[model samples]
Target chain A: MTYFHSVKLHEDKCKGCTNCIKRCPTEAIRVRGGRAVIDDARCVDCGECIRVCPNRAKSVVTDSRALLKDRKFNACLVAPSFFGQFRSEVSLGRILASIKSLGFSHVLEVSRAADVVASALSKHLLGPNVRYPALSTSCPAVVRLVQVRFPDLIDHFVPFDAPMEIAAYAARQEIKLATGCSDDEIGVFFTTPCPAKVTAVHQPVGQGHSQLTGALSMAEVYADAFKFLPKVTHEEPVYGSARGLAWAVSGGEGTAIAKDDYLAVDGLQHVIALLEEVELGRLRSVKYIEGQACIGGCVGGVLAVGNPFIARLRIARMSQRLVSASLPALDLAPSALTLRQTLLPRPFLQLDANIEVALQKLNELEALVGQLPMLDCGACGAPHCRALAEDIVRGTASSTDCVFVLRKQVSSLAGELMDLAGKLPPAMGRG
Target chain B: MVEQAVLEVAYQVVGGDFSQAGDGASRLKRVLQQIGLAPALSRRIAVAAYEAELNIVIHAYSGVLKAKVSPVKVEVWAEDQGPGIPDVELAMKEGYSTAPDHVRALGFGAGMGLPNMRRNADELEIKTVLGEGTIVYMCFANRA
Candidate 1:
């Protein structure tokens, strides 16, 4: 029952203007005591709050450079989105070399793992028991969202380790055999674009534990990579296929798998809509769904630098340059890429622990909703009237907390006072 | 331990409004989920409700989809004023749709509606008046 969240609210910086609460896909946030509070059970760590918070109060929890310096042997597992942040002209080799200069012993590209995932996914799709419109499990936020909001569709999720997890395993194995270090001695760090990856590493959904030691934000590593790009002399061996590198942007997985009826949706809201269609059984014709939490895939991550469109363009140019090249032999064992454990649904919004109690609450909620004006105005510090009713049932709020309801009560009391004055007070004053 | 309480909610379905066809079922699904029903049970109810909703939209003039929830079972009653099916047995058969070609072009009326609903619901009862309308009742057991 341990909870690990990558996004944290900085108390001093939070203005509690209800921006994050309104934008949060899961309604996991509440503005209480003039500051935003995140419900750990409901947060999926999509970093949407980090993106929408005007005061920059929302920030990611990541491993610092000091932690990297302490490791005996450090290996950086680079997300393909990392390449999109740099100039299009920069070679992948130069980017790899630049990452090495940031105090790392080895640099591994997650795209290579993505290639393995693409292969595994194709094989899974060809199986007789494959679920129709199987959802991609690569995006941790998407997986968590499904667990919370679309529990019945959990079986539709393709059971496989994400490219980051696979890359961390491969990177650790390579670094271990080369340096003859113990597992604890080699720190495998992932350069992540979103906070969900950080949460994934710390509290993995389908695995016993993450192979990665920690995650470093792409934004945090960008400046160092840029400063050292020209200084590196040694050329790092290329490991990623063109199709694999394409995983950094939206539609890349569907395209790489060569599925004609696959759907690729980006942005948290769009993904939610697509999942809703899937829930309604309207997407029966689709073979697979690739959902990314960010608008333009990993390139549009909250922690990523530059505009998403520009980053996507750069990634596309990079893909075009490498598409014609032959793929290298994979260095890791293919069997290691499969997920070791099953992911269970996380029903974050369950009405109550007891079903009978929940039904009673539902009745109470219905009664309360009937009494309130259905104006979804966020005047009560809750997102909507329905939400306020739920809060009232939970004993976290009262009906009078609503400004409209309070105004009605005040006006009615004033009318009663006026009527009494007309009847008795006027006679006493005249006499 | 006390007598189970049944909570009922009614939705008005407009005919030929493709955009709003699934709204009733979707809302019902959310309610079931929030009521702490098992996912499998909730899904079955949702699928049955959706198919029934779609049937009214495609063939009926207008309809009312009502969902009743209790501790023992979840029930959906869909009644519509439309040209009733001459043969309920034929209507229940897969790929036996009588929808116009235009409806077929919209990717619906492959005639899987009633069959799919039957497949998901534990109990189904249909009542229709030849020239007037049809009423379909679906029930799902709320087993722990």
Candidate 2:
């Protein structure tokens, strides 16, 4: 099967540094032949490599601005994090109006869908026979991480479409009803915060197909939207609730649920640690876990501009100013939330396909690890001694690739050559 | 009958070293994960190993935590040399504890260690002498 990945590597700009390999949460990257190669099955598109690469070799694949001109009736689903990218003084109305001038016929708020999801989740938590410590599935990167690394916790993920998908569905329906455009004529583009959302739109995890036509990066539309800032006379009708607006920042979803026993963790590494604790069964007491791959949540997405802290502050201010309201009436049938396909474990790091073979490889890996210097230096293009051992066992590398081992072997060979020279008969004594 | 392959690893746990109490279990968990064991099974083994290790750190002078891994199951053995429990039955009780007030304050001695081990492990066995030491054996099935 062909897998869709939004993260692309620019080979010419790559320095082949081990920086991204060490930072990648899924360990999906390997430096082979002076280029970083990503194992598509393991990559969750968390954008850590994009953030860590000093040469800017990594970029996300998003729909171009020309895609907007191609569609007859273009509708844009604006993410809540997009509001945080603007200046503090910029009103949400101005931003929405500016987006409208960019040739979008309809500008729908994703936070409205978030409001519906929050309400649905609150009811689900209060309902009977619910699992404790349910995990949030809103973050595509976190969901993919669970599928890849924490397969045991797959059942713990709440079975629901993300707010973006729900908003796309709503936007498409409303655009079709109002403009009388066919599905192909109306293009619903999601203004996404990260590349994972782009991947999600292309190849959704639980659903058969995504409601979104494509994803546009916030960075792509920021300048165009900013240029048309003063074109609006009046503020458009806003439908998002205060709690929904809070979803732009970390801990917002947990706060929206108002659960007493919840953990809100952000940052890819921090989320990994939290998942580890959950996997160890140490977090049995927690009722919910909200994990975001970005540091401060969606506002800290790789495509987002401005400092995350400042963005968070602005989002918080915007949420505080909004009036509390219940979710608007929308078609939220059971069919809308049900998944058509089941998510299976990726098993990206499985040692071998056969258990018996994997066992033998594990033993070999242990022996190789014992012989290694254990310096954890990234000299051999592997992260550490254990990783090098794994690479050797997988036949991608050799034990002699270690600089220390090579040096030691060279010295020993030199000593043996000297000893052999001394042992040779006195033929050289005349010289 | 074919002989099943097994891998064994051991760690030393120092007495009253609260900071390093879970080190053995943590490493064991990582090994289990790397070997591609089911997460639920790995978690069960880790929990049992951690509880046994903590018991040794809090109550015993010193101990060795050993993990034996096979395709079928994972076995954790903790042997400690220190003052042993006089009543194995009482020690197994949920609320019964001989831990000092300071230890309890530090949240080390909740008397739930053995019970938690029993709850997480598929099979648990405890043997103790009044003065010499204690030994805990826990096994978890590596179900796919």
Candidate 3:
């Protein structure tokens, strides 16, 4: 299946360096033909490649900042991490106002929708048939990672639409009501800090369609923010427990929904380790698992211009200042917030469609792997020695692609040539 | 291709190695995933396999865990040379265990091992000889 991936390789900029292949959690990247190739089916679009690509070859597919400068009723749904991009002293109101100056007629908070999601999640925990140690559905990259890698944990996903979806829907409704515009006339865009959100907007996993029109990377918006930030006055809209702003940081969502009994894991590698423990039936006593693909949560998104730690600190300070107010009532029903479609496992890693054939291939792969050097060196254009063996079994690679194997073949051929040098063809009779 | 329908993988489990306790079961899961077994099947068996492995780690001198997989079904057996269960029926109970305090301190002996195995595996069999050893057999039917 051709899975949609917002993260892509810029061929001209690509050095085909093995850096991305090693960092990819799913081993989705391979350096072939002196260029890194991403297997879309295997990619969870976590933007790890973007972070590791020293050549700046990896880039995200998002709307050009110019798109915001249209006459259509463009409403920008602000992520919590966006607040983390600005200095803590820059009040939230001016930030929203500055964004409005950039062409958005209205600004809405995804965090507000996150507040709605948190309450629903809290209620969900108490409900029957709730999978214990529920995995948060908030992070799109983490969700896709589970689909492709940890299929068994599919049931563990909390059956809630992500705050981005909920926020987009709310953005449209409010924009239509306020401006008396038709659905076609209004556009809702999320200022995202990661490429995964762009993919999520384009190809939502849990729902049939997303309400978001498009996504604007925070990095693209940062320049405008910088220019406008200095002139705008502080206007942090202090209303309805801005508690959800904490969602910018790791464990914030879990802490908001469940007072305790939650395990928070951050960064893709750490999240993978945590999932392995869950697979081994560990952490069953924990009520929830808060997983984020980025180290400090959304603030650590690849598209974010600010340092993740600094962004996290800004959010922490801002959240503290927003005195706890009564929460705004949840605007919709369970159907509105819950997943409409069951997530299907992406079985791209399966060796073959036929189990028997797959078994034979696996055995063959094991044997082939034993012959090759176990060095996970990326000289073979694969992440590791075993991965290359799998590729060879899959008919996409050759064993001789390994430099060590090729050298041995070349040396043997040279030896054969040396023996042949003495024995010319009978007809040629050359010394 | 040898047309061999069944494939078997076996691993040895060292006793009281808390750090490496789940290694055998983890490898088994990787094989299952590579073979393209149904996720539901692998998930249940992995859970059961981990419990059985943990039982060996907590109580046995040593053990060998083996999985045999055909197209239609998968079977796993863990043979441990440990002090056998005094009462098989009692040991199968959810809260009954012969584990020492040290094992329980590491959260290895909540007494749910056998019960969890029974719950997860479609079919389960246990053979034990007091002062001798124990052998566990679990079977899971493959589903489309």
Candidate 4:
């Protein structure tokens, strides 16, 4: 099955302008057969395609109110980025109440799980075999990109679950402990600013399955969150401070896992560049590298209702009085209570760390790469020639993925391939 | 007549021109995509093509990348008209290189080029005429 959650093309709306195709880091979209087609396996769901599509052909998957249909007890784990998207006048307490008003039985701040992730990462970072840098896996798109493009650098990624995953785990654990709700009876939903987080919930990383029932886009939940604020007051102070809250921004992970020797990078391209730096041993001294697939952190998400700059300013202003010092202390339910420090999936390294397949795929791809014209025009929707090569190897796509490459190849081979030129040699010949 | 056209794309290795270094690879990627290969094949070709392009622009002196795309497959050949490889086998090793200090300053020259090309392509052939030009041939098959 193709691995993707959000960032699908609205076939009818796509004008085949190549705007969305050019922006995709993985070149997952292409103007094929006169319209855009998303190569599911190649797409990291970073939402770059959504941001640049003028025709609004690109879209994210969403949970219908129908998701709430069968569940008995439901809770909303609000992401901190929400504070930045709405009016500061609406107290965060009111936002929680607003979420509660949306029929959620309870509202818990995801920042609480951020605390758990931070604590786990800190301990993991301070441990031995600190041989490689730790890459934050908070963003699923970023993690998937690592799996697809920077497989060798996977070792650098801390195997610990992301803040959202940990949040889902902890939130569910708390719910079950307090109310004795069966796993199926209680549903946990995440308020997401970006599509990758949603995909992560559906197709989990680090562990086999995510505890999250589904995700509610921050944009979608905004109106509901705002409407309920007038009735309730945010009584208990949230966990995490401006710094922790800042975690919603680019490089926030550096602060959360502040080890002095860390490199924080955001934006899909920028993060990929940093990973290349690590793979090249250029950043060998670096202990941790925090990579967010989106620019300006989650606020830069394509699905966000407003601009990141405005969202960041609002988030900062709202948390300004709280002070960074007030951020909650690192909390880990004693190691004894936590299972024997087993990172989910037993052998996390096998997920994408081993370059064996990537290497073999690379070799198979190499044979086909030399034929491609060196014009990373991104028209093929696999980003660059190299990405297109890897996508072909992964089986989700074919070399004809690039329109320019196919044209050039067919044109160049016209003389020798005259036998099949009866119909322009079929772009990719046969397949 | 079977045409034997050698297309050459030259690039300058600006010690730290990180932004433009990938330009060659990007162009090559577009070319491959236009040829109508699969995404996986295109990505592999692109990765190998870029790595080679970066090697020329990153470690070698101003160099030329040439390719011959045919019906059966494509072949990219990179030749560096700079100091030749001192040890082909060693250079092909995972982490070995003789790049200058300035080149190393930029974060590349990890000595993964030859090996990476070998890993990314179907058949990789490298011939270095010491103190002269080094010729590397990478062939990519077109399943079509």
Candidate 5:
């Protein structure tokens, strides 16, 4: 069985829409016995199911409190979008304090890492032979999609680590230096609003494993932050430009890639369609493309609280209120930028990157897909289209993998009940 | 005469359109899936068959991707009327590709096509004559 570090589907909460079953890239989930079941084998743990489920059934298996209970030095790198979830009166510092009260020794704003990524991206984007424009590597889901679906555009992906990865690396480095602890002794957790980050921890891009100890969801942190807001003291705000702050939006990466060139696409289906155009060479001259699998970028993540619109407003307001005009200049800090770039894992899309097992699985999948009905009805608790195609190919599922087949069986049974009930009562019939 | 195949797709390649060469192969892959071929084998066959078809589309003046499905494997034939490979041995190398700059931009012309086709298909056969057209026959074993 393939090991899935994330992509947990709660059975009791699932309404059996099978939406997740269809949306999963690896055909990881199957609907069986009136519930969606996650197959460990086929699942790459991409978390597409968590994003599409309206009933809030699909969830990630995050790091437990046990992992943090007795930890010596634990640091939390909070996402900026968390600021927009609650009322505006509660400042972000209070939220950080709330998390700090819950056993965290220190809390660092991830926005600082965003500052570093900006400088790195600018330098890389200005490189030679980068004619096709650079694509942002921020969204792990979008990056994975490119690896599997659009390998042709692999070079177009900006050769840089995302803000989250950079922040995790920086946070770890800082904690060790400040606390005088070994690298392994310092635990670093990312306050994420999505499950993709959780998957990224295990199967990181450019690197086989992540430096992050774990991920804490934004929704999971909201209650504690709200209750602790009154007790904590607020810290001075960190500074970043409006454009950098705008990374919370759908096309924010594109804006950063090039003001006059490039395009940004949001939402999973929309991004998939645009990728087809890119693969077909229709957008050849375009310099950069920012593809976010989520609707409003990170703010609209499934694990986030409230609507993305509110989050956008909060981000905008926060950006405008920044006290500093320019970023603090780097004072020849030993070229941390170069070291940071090397720290990132190379793109895992290389043909040398484990095509042997993938090839074997592909053979098995091809055989199974042939036997399926090709309906892609999304009845199997999976979304329709090719995902179901991949599901059946893997031995974890079968042809009845579609839930519609079972629904039809149940409906026919219901029809029999209605017909039988239409007859008169026994006494009346006898009379 | 019984027109043997219910579906037949053909394309004409203008010299340097190597990047767009995979379009036809991808369409063929979808069609194979639509006709209810198992996905695992379809994926394997799709890769090899796509590589073969891409070779013809990119290098040849014109080519055809023809397929027919039965209870078992789907039989595919890619016939190209372009300048044929002079040496079948050297052409089969894993890194051998004749694609040009414009093609490279589109991610093709990587000399991995012939080898990839052999890897994906259950059975593959290629017949070529220098200065004449070439024909490739491939089969993706139907596990359905």
Candidate 6:
């Protein structure tokens, strides 16, 4: 089975470098044949490759501005981090007005949907079947990471759709009631900060179909918003409470879920470290965990135009001015908000289908690892020596691919040629 | 009726070292996962092995955590050279521990180690001689 990913590489632009290969959390990318090929099963669409690519070879697949012309009724569901991009002088009303002026009929806030989800979280935590230290399902990359690398922690995910999905769903409803339009006529889209959310718009994990019909990069929308800013005279009122808007930063969701018991961890490395501990059955005391893939939360997404620190500060200041912990009510169906599909484990690490073959491969892999130089240099096109060893046993790579091993073989062959050059068979040999 | 496994691996666990508590179990988990064992089964074995390893780290002078893998089942052994249990029966209870106050402050020494190991593993055995040492052996079937 194959999964959709928003992260992709420009084959023409690739210099066959090892930058993206090393940054992939799942070791999914390999520089093969002068290009980076992504193993679809292992890619979580975290967009780390796009960030590390010195040549800007990696790109994200997002809905273009053409969607505005294509759709009849366009509703743009804005991420909380989108607000952080604007200056302090620009009021929320002007920002909302500017986004609407960019060919959007309705500009909905995902942060408002975040409030709705946050309200239900405490009660959900009290459920009988709820797992302790429940992992957040908000970040699609984190969800995919759990599926690929940490299967045991799948049950820990809080079974709820992301705020984006909920926001899109609510927007579609409101748009339908207001305009008397059919579901297909109303296109609900998200202005996403990360490629993971873009991937979610295509292939969501918790639900069968995402409410969002499309996703646009926050950076793409930022330019258009600024261009339309001056011409937009009417300032429409924006929605979302202080706590809801705070979801743009790390630990924001944790504060909403619990007063002090919840733990919010950001940055993939730190998230992975905490998850390893969680997998070992530690952190059992904590009730909730807010895990985001990007640093400083969505504001740090690679596709965003603003600096993460500045964006984070802007969001903090904006949330403070609102001063309302209480959120405006959104009418939504229970079935529409909850996760409809059960998350499944992605067993990419499994060696083989048959136990005997897998065991043999494991032994062969271990032995092959022992024979190789453990420098972990990416010259072999793999993330490290062990990954290359795994690829060797899997029949995708050869031992001689390692530069050091190749050098040794070339040296030995050169010596043998020299020996042959010096002497021959008895008939050709000199006394 | 345990026969020789096709593969065996060992990891060293230093006594009273909380930093290295889950190291052995973590490595073993990766191996079992690569071998394509069911997630639930691998998790059970990992939990049992983790408890056994943590016990050695918290109580024993020093020990070796070993794993033996066959097609059907996996075997784990923790052999530690330190003060053996005075009462095995009491140790198997849910809330029984002799760990010092310092260890307890680290959120360990909950006295659930032996019980958790027993619950998670398909079979468990303990060999201890008072004032000498203790060896814990646990087995888990690969399939649920």
Q: All models, DockQ values?
A: 0.68, 0.52, 0.70, 0.06, 0.06, 0.61
Error of 4 at A94 (Å): 2.6
Q: lDDT per prediction?
A: 0.87, 0.83, 0.87, 0.68, 0.66, 0.87
lDDT of 4 by residue, B1-144 (tens): 744322233444442356777666655654444444444565576678767777767656666666665446778877777566777888889988777687778766778777878887999988888767677789988675
- TM-score of each model, paired residue for residue: 0.96, 0.93, 0.94, 0.68, 0.64, 0.96
Lowest lDDT block of 10, candidate 4 chain B = B4-13
Predicted candidate 2 versus true structure: per-residue lDDT over A1-431, tens digit per residue = 55789999999999889899888898888777888989888899999999999999999999876887778888888899999988767777768878877888888888888877877887787777666678988899999998888887888877667888888888888888888888888889899889999999999976478888889999878877877786667665566566777888899887556666788999989998788767656676777788999999999999998788999998878776665333355566655654444776666666877666777788898899889999977777776789889989989898778889999999999999999888857665665
Q: List where candidate 6 sits over 4 angstroms from the true fold.
A: A323-327, A418-424, A428-431, B1-5
Of 2 and 5, the candidate ranking higher by DockQ: 2
Cand. 1 TM to true fold = 0.96
Residue A294, model 5, lDDT? 77
Off by over 4 Å in 4: A2-4, A233-237, A257-260, A323-331, A334-431, B1-144
- Against the native chain B, each candidate's TM-score is 0.96, 0.95, 0.96, 0.82, 0.82, 0.94
Put down candidate 1 lDDT per residue, A61-156, tens digits, no spaces: 887877776679999998999999998988888899889888899888999889888888888887888889888988999999998899999999
Ten contiguous residues with the weakest lDDT in model 2 chain A: A323-332
Please provide, for model 6 over A245-320, each residue's C-alpha lDDT reduced to its tens digit, 9 standing for 90 to 100: 8888888786566566789889887888888788777788899988899998899999888998898888877876
When candidate 6 is compared with the true two-chain complex, its DockQ is 0.61
Q: Candidate 4 residues A1-431, lDDT tens each?
A: 44646766778987777687677786566666668887676677888878877888878896765687689888888887777778766666656667777887777777666666666667887798865676777788887887655554555666666666666766677778889988999888988888888788787654366778998888888876666566665543456456557677777667656556877788898987776555433455677887888788888887677788888788778777563332345455643113222232111111123333433444466677887776887666555787677667756568777777678678878866776555654466564
Which residue pairs overlap in candidate 3's backbone?
A: A93-A235, A93-A236
Alpha carbon lDDT at A149, candidate 3? 92
Cα deviation in Å at residue A166, candidate 6?
A: 0.6
Question: Considering every candidate listed, which one attains the maximal TM-score?
Answer: 1
TM-score, second chain, candidate 4: 0.82
Pitting candidate 1 against candidate 2, the one with the higher lDDT is 1
Best by DockQ: 3
